[model samples]
Target: MTTVESKTTSAEATKLTVPSRPGFRIGRLSLVRRPFKVLVNLVLLAALLMLVCINIGRGDFPLSIGHVIDVLLGGGTRIERFIVMDLRLPRSPTGVLVGMALGMSGAVTQSISRNSLASPDILGITAGASAAAVALIVLGGGSAFAGVLATLGLPLAALIGGIATAAIIYALAWKRGVQGFRLILVGIAVNAMLTASIGWLLISADINDVSRAQLWLNGSLNGADWGSVWPVMSAVLIVGGLTVVSSFTLGALRLGDDNARSLGVRLQLRQAALLLAAVALAAIATAAAGPVGFVALAAPQIALRLVRTPGPPIIASAILGGLLVVGSDLIARTILPVELPVGIVTSALGGPFLLYLLVRSNRKASA
Candidate 1:
């Protein structure tokens, strides 16, 4: 090559190597700052605090933010103590933990499947947990054992269901190798069957038991305590932390399975690991919060839109998911005369968002 041509090529290579800076960038408003992330983190923290306050501040004897803080710090009235410390505090943390798991798990599923529509609920994972839990509830089986089975057993069952579901979908989609669209299609079909089964189970129950099962099925944090929170939180944190570290490879996978494999990404091993992590996260979250939907789906999408980047964005999604779930839980508690189920609240918000994503994905695929 000529000297000028080689020089031009080198300059182009340099341009390609330049990393884009993250911040609020707009026409004549390119204010770059390191504290930008800190600021965003602060905003999320503030939102979480505000939601907690709102959650505690409502109900029969509402407490102010100051009072809530004081109670948390061990310096409030007996009434404030009971309301904030005894009642509201536990649910808030459960929301945060469940939300984080959902978000992180959703990001993993989307990344591994290479599809935006992929989520815990869409893949029959939540349905699996819900089915198992509902079966326990409807069978007139009430005990510490049943509760444990519902809370912890469901997640384990969900892990099995999720892994099995993924395996089946992957197997069905394996036209020599897995295809994202085919996997997604099979996942949706499986989800429909599982959901139908759950409906039938609920239908077969008596009126009172049907009501009880409905509450659990709808995904409420109404009576959630720290007892239920810790186990799920521990599982989610371990899985999420490990997955966050593997995010770089996840990003590379977005380039397509073949390209990633050609780059020596060990497509099978990485995918299996990711799918296991994703299922574990979803199961823990579901067990904690009764198949709380849409946080997994909505949180990752919200994080992606906020960060304006492609790939998993697992950490951001986890943070956003925590915020979304905690905030939604707060809303469910305080929005009306009667407390709403957290799952119902998420479905109300997330269902529309899922439809929008579906439409957008279809348009992109068509285009």
Candidate 2:
């Protein structure tokens, strides 16, 4: 039989037969088939690239985009090199990496839960990271040891917290077996409790420490350097690799557990792998950028709506999240008279959409 597949569409379309070979298989054929989605993803990348250059050139000591490109390509004046290579280059990529990580995490999370609202931020994973990082910053001897704490201690703390929270939510949601709705409910409760704990920590800290903790809580890439960029890049590569490897299993999972099992998908193993990857990505991204809200919650859903695919489209989601974050950070830094944290801009953008999702979800449940 000839292979036929639905290129991403809101309405069903005739399956088109695409020529495929051994090296470039059906999965690769999907890339060829979904040309429109691919073009949209490319546009998002171009926008992100433009924003990166724009962000690099925007500051008190402004440089040109041409100069930024020259420095990036390894030929510029000493000051230009320092500005583009040493300073600004790291910042935009940091945002992109964090966004990609959150986007991937969100895609896996929503796909695994089979719920559109199921994101790391909404489910307490980011809150758990925030709480742990806050405790370490406010109470772990303050900025005197900030170099050591930020580089060594806090990321580790956040990862542990996220994993612990994920475990707890899974346990609480487990009745006979885990259900998506129960998992989401448990996550919401867990998120609320963690948020309250973050508030308490904020109130109890010294004023200086409060300032330091606030930066993390608000999630800024201001003055971010190579140190921050590498870990997030490493995470996006590793966890992203795992997600790509497990895509078939993930697609099987959307078929429901029994159907998945009949098709030889190791339900528990696949679920655990997907969750571990998602939790790890979200934890590291939070550790890098603080609890940058709404990117995780919105990116995959936006991608899903755009792609109209059966499962969360990870590539589109990552691109959309990166675009959203990079654009938001640009506005935060350059547009306003006072620089706002990138988180504030994202929250402003995401809040109304999130409310709409919640109301729609509630109405659906009631109906």
Candidate 3:
């Protein structure tokens, strides 16, 4: 064969031997597209929408799904609009944004730690936020000045507390570098300390303040309003976008530290940045919804199993997180004789799941 013909044949052989990833490229931008992942996300999104409608229609008035959709699209009467828009709309969206944040946060943490059990809640991020918020509530109770501070300062306090706690955990975990096992161990210890602090604050506070703090601690969507939804939405959009962009490195990180280093991954810097993103997401979600439990721990793992990814896919995890929160909230509202906190329902679900994971892990180890 001529030189050009041989070269062409070699190129074709290379192409045949190297399997392209299942995705599309558009000039400068490319995405790894998994059809199953897309379908799962779409299904989750649809389920989330349906739940939102059902949630909006719930209550004494009881509007139908069709009516809810009509009112949502600016077709209903003023009263219907008032009920859907003014009264009930905020809670569902708030739940969704919170769920998405937790979901992504969980995915990042779990991926970084390479532990199925690693999550913001387990790592004390949620506990730190809760501690700060509860302290604000209890310390600032009874006075007009305190009430104002509690109203305005709670979210900020929670965010700061979570970030600080994460920093401490990371610092403690860092010997030569942050190992996944060390990080998780440090997180659990910190979580215990923070939980103890929260308990102490509650005990020392006034009765009424304790009652209020307890309500908040239960993680209810009882008073979620437009005001609360905006911050979480903003966090989910901005920080979440950053997390998703950074996720390209997660697969590398998951392949063990030595392997990741061999692949030119800056182990310390990348891990810290990703962990910071996870902390921010978890903090914001906790601030909005009072540390809604188990969604963070469960969502990413559920998504991981469903999509059959080596690690949790961020988008799918976020969607599943939203679905879990919305569905749990629906059950909280309707399934019982009285309204229960969303966190309670989630804990009930997550506790069993955690045990199952532990059992499964043990079995695998033994085998």
Write down the lDDT of every candidate, Cα atoms only.
0.78, 0.84, 0.90
* Candidate 2 runs further than 4 Å off: 1-33, 141-152, 362-367
**How close is every model to the real structure, measured as TM-score?**
0.85, 0.87, 0.92
Expressed as tens digits, the lDDT of each residue in 216-300 for candidate 2 is: 7888888578888888899889888889777778788888879889989888778877998999999999988888899988998
* Segments in model 3 whose C-alpha atoms lie over 4 Å from true places: 1-16, 20-23, 141-152
Scored by lDDT, the top model is 3
> Ten consecutive residues with minimal summed lDDT in candidate 2?
1-10
lDDT, candidate 3, 151-264, per-residue tens: 768777788889899999999998988888899999999999999998998998989989998999999898899999988999899999998887778989999899999999
For candidate 2, what's the RMSD?
6.1
Backbone clash pairs for candidate 3 read none
lDDT of 1: 0.78
Model 3 residue 121 CA deviation in Å: 0.8
List the candidate numbers ranked by lDDT, top first: 3, 2, 1
Ten-residue region with minimum lDDT total, candidate 3: 141-150
Cα deviation at 227, candidate 3, in Å, is: 0.4
Task: Give the alpha carbon lDDT tens digit for every residue of 1-367 in model 1.
Answer: 6999999999999998875665577786554454555566567767777776777677778777887888888998888888787877888888888888999989988887888888888877777767766766675456564555566454565565566666776677778666677777887888898889878878877788889878877888887898878877787668888997787679878899888988889987888788778888887777677888888888888888876667657877888888888777777777656778888888898989999998998898899
Q: 235, model 3: CA deviation in Å?
A: 0.4
